[model samples]
Target chain A: MNAIVSAPAARLVHVPLGERAYDILIGSGLIERAGHEIAARLKGRKAAIVTDENVAPLYLDALVASLEAAGIVSASLVLPAGEKTKSFEHLMTVCDAVLEARIERNDAVIALGGGVIGDLSGFAAGIVRRGLRFVQVPTSLLSQVDSSVGGKTGINTRHGKNLVGVFHQPDLVLADTDVLNTLSDREFRAGYAEVAKYGLIDKPDFFAWLEANWRQVFAGGVERAEAIATSCQAKSDVVVADERENGPRALLNLGHTFGHALEAATAYDSRRLVHGEGVAIGMVLAHEFSARLNLASPDDAKRVEAHLKTVGLPTRMDDIPGDLPPAEVLMDAIGQDKKVKGGKLTFILTHGIAQSFVADDVPSSEVLSFLKEKHPR
Target chain B: MNAIVSAPAARLVHVPLGERAYDILIGSGLIERAGHEIAARLKGRKAAIVTDENVAPLYLDALVASLEAAGIVSASLVLPAGEKTKSFEHLMTVCDAVLEARIERNDAVIALGGGVIGDLSGFAAGIVRRGLRFVQVPTSLLSQVDSSVGGKTGINTRHGKNLVGVFHQPDLVLADTDVLNTLSDREFRAGYAEVAKYGLIDKPDFFAWLEANWRQVFAGGVERAEAIATSCQAKSDVVVADERENGPRALLNLGHTFGHALEAATAYDSRRLVHGEGVAIGMVLAHEFSARLNLASPDDAKRVEAHLKTVGLPTRMDDIPGDLPPAEVLMDAIGQDKKVKGGKLTFILTHGIAQSFVADDVPSSEVLSFLKEKHPR
Candidate 1:
């Protein structure tokens, strides 16, 4: 608890996964110090930074300069910005670039943007030369709080999102909170959905804190850093407990199953629904579904929705700015999720706030009916 | 000793890699027993078999029948048989196929071909759903003794062979020696190169045994089983000692540095030189280079060449049946090898028979000069 509330000048959350353990450094201006920090921890002096076109103009130069100052040589590959970048084609390009740069097993492949770049680059680093040292410099709040902390690096395939990937943990993560200042209001709000998720999964007090200090967190300062650190810590705990997602780690996907379905339903058009927004709507639906199942109170569902809505997040299917498919279509999307085992629905259902449990035998008929009742006319 | 000579019914060499440890079951008719063996060891009832076109007609039906007999539902993906099949295109295909088959994490992806299919499919299995249980039903000698044992799964990039891959260990390996009956004389002889490699690396007695009983081993029975079992055990020991090739595992790459350069020189053209043929020549070159460096007697080099030549394998650049690349070009290929650390050449030089060691700082000038001396005009 003390660690979570520590002064936010810079928060270092260490993910202790034995030999693969790494530190997540969250602070302002950390990117300016990226070179020295990376050189101090990693043996290789060469790095290949994979960023997006959007982020490249913003921070790639500064990052390269920092690495140069630390005497670490680097090359940069800037891909198109967006969720579409997480594809096999992009993965191959990044891998080839890393190889062309002669980034060896000990050399670093740094992901210097949001989740897409982080995931795509992290995957290239994982497979190129059978695994290189990976570093995540997450630019968005969503990534800094969630994706960057866990070593779940991968790309999306036609069959589904994140259906292909590796569990390649990073050697270091530099989450420069200052960069969050550059995010759009929607992007920042979308990221907040994940921050709220950490609390909803297991930390009721943290959820309560975010609810009380939502404004301060949005304004960005000690509160923002505190929120990010706690979220990372929560994710790290889940990841370390079940690094392979064999059991309790499923709790972290509380809204993801439904969220992924919604994203699929919207054809993953960011104009209609981005990942975190899908998650926002999905989290509300999860709570509502739990209530319908008599597993939690409907008041808890309303509370979840209200917090997300207050943070400027989309909290319902109708909240999406496009016409979604029928409930049956959404159910088909859920059925396609890798989470289904032996043709049975497996979901993270809650008893109440911060009390999620993995329900491995959730009936599909029940979910379809729930979606039907909630579907926008 | 008893373990090595156990009455030839079937030999199970347990690779003791802690939690990731698995068994290599080597014997005749094991493919017919693959389903039972896999079912007994794995919890999954579903499997996706990735095989090359050449092997599918020969073994796919029998494998499917065996799995059906054991109550395992199976899907088969037939790919073209060759080193070229180890590519990102095929990797994506296998991954997509596995996902389309809805193979869960607990399910299995079985490789039922040679090194190319095993490498590609194992990579897919490792990544799909972040990893599925993998089973290797290696139908080729090279695969049975080497590629299938180590869990070094990957695809080739335009940069190099095995330049991209993952360390995805299989849950079980069924090395059906009876499959060897279907192999061509050339293919069998090519595989014999790796069988002899185990002996050359650290087993003087095994080398002497192979030299004495080479005929019986080639004839295929107890001696052939002994050769494969010994090779697998030797490889398992090295992998257990260093799974990631950070240390002693480099010894397994004995002859491989020169072999890869030769393969590159020939443009990986199978008609010009196959992998094991390159290895056959490279082992001779490695020993000859060791002799030139005064690391071992020239008599040892002569002996290595004599055995391989007697076994109908190419033992020199001149034996490659085509014009050879200039020494400088070959050196360029060697320089590009991932084994090169900070621009210094790394090779497996030997002290004497069965006493190979990783030479981390081998002088490139010496290698060039040695290649020039050995180059055929």
Candidate 2:
């Protein structure tokens, strides 16, 4: 992890999925070089850039100019920016726009925003023409560190989030740290939750390093790039080991099960809690639940809550504004989670910090009791 | 092929997709034994059957009884029958119903009808939980031989048919020939077109055999089972070789490009033409187109048209009930075909019967001119 941070040049984390293998380039100023990198990798000269309203004004011109410099003709689709945009309605819009753009199978669909844009665009790319060449230009830190690296892409349904989609890997992923400099402080902190999640998953040394040098990471430079690279490397390793999330990959969802339930409980209202914020609280809850189950030390849960609180992330259910539903309602949402295999809850519980493992058939009564303690009545 | 037809209690064609490999069981009485076969292969004791209105009344109860006999809990969603049913609306309905049934990842999603039901239900199964155990109990001849074996599951979009879907293979396929006895005469003849397609796609001897024994196949004894198994074998070979339709799999699209265009021309009206009828005409056009390009003898084209005509399948654009759009309009639709690469038309042209190859850069003017001859203004 330190070697990756100390590297002077741009870092390339290769996700090895045999024939579907591709590289995730992490460093400063990647958006400017995206054209050359993408052109070098793919033979197509046409591209469709799918961005959100918030992102297009900031980076669309630069990306289009970069592609133009590389002799790649391009079209753009600017969607509304928010979690709400990750729905079937927006999915159809993206699919239609792509087809209308005449983007062929060999051409590329460049997703140029956060997780919402990436998920929606990747899904459109996967289905349109039965599949198209896809490139991820994840502008947000949360997406760059996590969502961009994995092949999981989908839109949310009324039933649940990401319940309908496919595993369509991108041909290339450009994670430009330079772009994160433009992010608001709150947005960066939300994304940092995911960055910290990697360390909590299996890297004790890295978690300790973050505890010491998180200030430098927030200040933004080599440390920020290193954190992103480390996160990508960590995710890539797990994905390569289990592309379909059949086993070890579930470890990556340590915070996600509880996080998704929280999101669903709020009806995915981003103003109340964005994905990473929900994850921040969710991770604490996971640790607490682990401690409750005697799977881990209570001190580990306290440590997680303290660190997330220091970073200005929500670490408790109370952090969310307005009154949420009862604990039983939250449990109902969790029951509907995609992780519940064969009517039994499956969770990533920790033995200690950086020692996460999948625990299947987790008793729902225990989860309800835990939530009940967190939210009285 | 003869060896497979003769000494078989039930012919098994193994589709070798490595880890995703499974067997296609073909014969009479397989439906009665479906529950046992599925229970033996998969650990789950629950299934959600997605059939259509026409099929549910005919076989749903028997299927339910079979599952009960094996101690497998089963539920079903009966959709309206037809090509039009393969839509996002119906897809969402199936997804919701399956979720409402609480069908877990280990459970199976059984498609128990023709092409529409198979495509839609398979798609629902694929996306329900990022995929579920899919079983194809295809009832119609079209589905048994063609759609059921391949994992290409999806819904038709406003842009084109099958424009939105995933390549999700089934865990097991049960194609009972006895079910074909109940199909309408037109539907049976329509399905025979796909069965004959296998023979036309690289198996000259199979084509010869099909031409000789088509009447016997229609009579529904051993010959029907042989033809279905042979078609599945032919398709399985191509699918296993190129699971994603990247190379040799394109050969399977011999008539689909023209056929899809014709379907679009007729607005996908069953009163005018069904999919197989369109393919029958499209196959003749493809042969005639190849002959026009001096790639094959005109005699081959004539023989194909003659054979299709003898089978009571439409072999010409004139045979379609309604008037078609002008040649340029047809060419426009063909240009929008998903198979088009980089805006250039890609066709599967034949050298002779059963000797087809992917032909790229086919000129629009040539296709338009050919269509003009068929439908002069």
Considering only chain B, report the TM-score of each candidate against the true chain B. Answer: 0.97, 0.97
User: True contacts preserved, each candidate?
Assistant: 0.80, 0.64
- Model 1: per-residue lDDT, tens digit, B1-377? 01111234789899999999999999877877777788788877999999988999999999998888888999999999899899899998999899888898778999999998999999999899888999999988999999999889998877788889899999999999899999998999999999899999999999999999999989998888988998999999999999998999999998999999999888888998999999999999999999999999999999999999999999989888778779999998888788977667889999878999999999999999999999934
Model 1 quality (TM-score): 0.97
B1-377, model 2: which lDDT tens digit per residue?
01111223789999988889999999877877887788889888899999989999989998998887777899989899889999888987898888888788889999999999999999888877778999999999998989998799888877888888888899999988888888888999999989888989899999999889989999989888888888999999899888988888999898989999999988889999999999999999999999999999999999998988998999999899878999888888888888887677899999998889999889888988988987899
Judge the docking of candidate 1 as incorrect, acceptable, medium or high: medium
- What ranges in model 1 sit over 4 Å off? A1-8, B1-8
Chain A structural similarity (TM-score) per candidate? 0.97, 0.97
Candidate DockQ scores, in order: 0.74, 0.64
TM-score of chain B of 2: 0.97
Model 1 residue A286 lDDT score: 95
